[model samples]
Target: MKSFIFRQFEIRQSAEVFRVGTDGVLLGALADIRNARKVLEVGTGTGVISLMLAQRNPNAAFLGLEINQEAVQLTRLNFVNSPFHSRLKNIHQDFKSFSTQEKFDAIVTNPPYFEVSGSGKDKIARQTIELNFRELISKSSEFISEQGVFSVIIPAEAGNEFIKTAEEYHLFLIRKINIKGIENSKVKRLVLEFSLTGKALDESEFIIEKSPRQYSDQYLELTKAFHVFKG
Candidate 1:
């Protein structure tokens, strides 16, 4: 079975779509769930981030929106079998056309960022073929509540540009975590938080590994609650 068992939940992976990995886990674990009563996760490949956040924030209800049918089916099954089934819902829809009367207190996504040169399934997974960063910012600005927070994890190369675009919509950065694979490695991923208040940014670094096979203390500490191996 292509299933991964976590301390409080399990994810069944589908070969035809994007699968869970360290990036999603890190984003879910590190995002601020404070004051969040309703959450929305965009591009929820298998709903892993939503699951993690739901587990961490027991009072929050979650809605996961995915563009792929395969992923929607898989996420639905995973949510159904998890303890937070009553608090989670999965929908198959493109974010660009997604309409809802509800406003979310927390919004998170691990969006596609690479600039690729093809029109294949892999391109959909790696590149922004359907939804771009600018559109994400604009739509998020419209739907996020006054005190809500928006969070996302993306490649370092595109992250700065994303921050700039978000500023265009008056969504200011509140917190940022630079992610490096190791101590001396160049920054590769950025986990960022934005809000309407335009508060001063709280910045930090997170190294994923101490060496080739061992996880760093920061990574282990951040993910210990969900990762069985961390215990």
Candidate 2:
């Protein structure tokens, strides 16, 4: 059993489920969930993002929905083993067909972004074979409260099209973080937040590395509470 050790919790991982990665870490650390009382996480893999959010927001309750059976089970195990287990729950359900009368104050996801192509083992987790951008945006808009925010991280190149699709659902862009792999490099990923009411966009850039294999101060500071770096 592969595991990731954090300052406040540990995440057990499996090969069948999407293991811990940079994207999930970024979303978990950057998502705006401080004011959220109830949070919903789509496609929860190994339950790491929700776990991180739970640690960050003590007042929030989190419900994680995962379509993949193995992933759901993995998330459940990881959640149960964590200190924030009481506030976290995982369900085996497809987000596309999920319906809830209750609204979420924050809906977050590190969704599949790549277009369906080769038949890799991690196809469902990495490719848009199951959930596309339009479907994700439409469904999230339905469950988000009037003041809630829907947050996701996707490739920077797909940002414009994603924003256009979200606008169709009346979810206006509110916050955006341009993520770069290294200093003086082009933006590689975009962490976007949208809401029902439009507001002045809060845009910023984040660099992960100051040099090869060296973490940037911004990255280190943002994740100081979570990551347990080695000396």
Candidate 3:
């Protein structure tokens, strides 16, 4: 089976869709959604983040949106097979045009950050060609409740620009996690959380590895309930 077995659930994979990666795992394990009732996941490649968040926040209901048809189908399959299926729903829709009367308490995404350049099956899922940062920020600001958060994981180099764009939409940064591949290495990714109302920013660094090929204790602890790591 082309699947990743987790402690609580399993994710079926496909070559046509974006596969599971550290970015999604970090966002899933780190995104703040404890008090949220309604959560929205943008670009749910395999519904992994939503499943993880569902496991974390048992009371939250998730709506996952995917632009790619194949990925949307894949996400639906994954969502339905999970233990949290009762709380999850997946739809094939472009986020830019998605409208909802309901406000989401937590809007999360591991968005496409790369510029339009590559020609591949997962191009739309990896590049900003379909959904740019500005559009994402604007829509998230509109859909988020007053106390709600918009969380995302993106390239470290794009953090400053992404923050600036979010500010223009009246979304203030509330929390930040700088992700390093290994101890003493340069930060490679950022898990940022923004909200409609500003507050004292909480910032922290997350090291994924304590040494080469060894998962950091912090990473292991954070995902202990989800990742089924061999002893």
Model 2, 1-231: lDDT tens per residue?
758999998988888888899999999999999799999999999999999999999999999999999999888988998899999999999999998899999999999988956768788999998999999999999999999999999999999999999999999999999999999999999999999999999999999999999999999999999999887
1-231 in candidate 1: lDDT tens per residue? Answer: 478889999999977777888899999899998789999999888889999999999999998988888888989999999999999999988999999989999999998886676556656667888888998889999889889999999988887789999999989999999999998999989999999888888999999999997999998888888888933
Q: Residue 14: error of model 2 in Å?
A: 0.7
lDDT of 1 at 124: 69
Instruction: Please give the CA lDDT of all the candidate structures.
Output: 0.90, 0.95, 0.94
Q: Give the Å error, residue 171, model 3.
A: 0.1
Q: List the residue pairs that clash in candidate 2.
A: none
lDDT of 3 by residue, 48-157 (tens): 99999999999999999998898899888888898899999999899999998999999999999989665776889889999999999999998999999999999999
How big is the RMSD of model 3? Answer: 1.0
Candidate 3, superposed: residue stretches over 4 Å from native: 119-121
Highest TM-score, which number?
2
Model 1 whole-model lDDT (C-alpha atoms): 0.90
User: How many residue pairs clash in model 1?
Assistant: 0
**TM-score of every prediction relative to native:** 0.96, 0.98, 0.98
- Given candidate 2, what's the lDDT at residue 153? 97
Deviation from native of the Cα of residue 40 in model 3, angstroms: 0.4
